[model samples]
Target: MNPVIPRLARLFLIAFAGVVALIVVVQIVWINPGKRCEEAGNWWDWRGRACARPVLISDITGRVIDTPEARAAAKDHAASQKAAASKAAPEAVKP
Candidate 1:
């Protein structure tokens, strides 16, 4: 039985265990920046150091409601309101 061989094997095992523990710790505690940005959705712009949601250029001018779909909706809403108003109005009575 060689005592030196057993000692060397024990040292190797200890070093391996230390490395594995370090790797596990890093995996558990590390926060991935890219993952958070991706989860935020397509509106997020992750170009800079911090993750942020950029406002559209139209948003600044309060024109974000000017999409084709919105315009159509506005027209439909106006038509309905006009019809409602007219319905509530009294018609002329012919005596």
Candidate 2:
């Protein structure tokens, strides 16, 4: 009887721990979807209005859209990807 009780306790603890871990994972997946821009080696997920990171589809010379409808009509039709590349130009920073 003692052996059976110990085995049952162990099983119960394992199952409980699994449930808690699952909950945490679900929270993380749902919280952040698009984290590619914020951090490298990660992908973006724009689902259900959940964004793990922001997407800079265009250069950093635009306005900040703060509405729920984050659709940009200008960024998609741009011809200056090199503009953003020039942001790292050390020559311009000389004082």
Candidate 3:
């Protein structure tokens, strides 16, 4: 009865399981929108989003960078918002 090989295999399986569990917990707790409903106005707003089980989940890392197209879109969006804001406010009252 070779007990050593069996014990080593068991240990490896346990460590691998722990790592998997840790990753699952991180994704659920941090990145999953369903878990972060407190930051919203209504729960239904999350309906079509990733919380509806397994879509292309974004990175959990806080260092998420915009893709090239996304970056361009964001830049355009910000510029539009800035222009709107400037137009909405009267210029500095000539103080």
- Please say which candidate is ahead in lDDT: 1 or 2: 1
TM-score of each: 0.37, 0.35, 0.36
Which residues of candidate 1, in runs, are more than 4 Å off? 31-95
Kindly list the per-residue Cα lDDT of model 2 for residues 1-95, writing each as its tens digit. 57999999999999999999998886666544434333654455646543344457444657766654454544443435556657757777888
The residue pairs in collision within model 3 are none
Off by over 4 Å in 3: 34-95
Q: By the TM-score metric, which is better: model 2 or model 3?
A: 3
What tens digits encode model 1's per-residue C-alpha lDDT throughout 1-95? 98999999999999999999998865544435546665775333344436567666567877656589987997799799999888767563333
lDDT per residue for candidate 3 within 21-88, as digits (tens), equals 99998676555655565345334234354433223234444554468988688779879999989986
Best by TM-score: 1
* Candidate 1 residue pairs in backbone clash: none
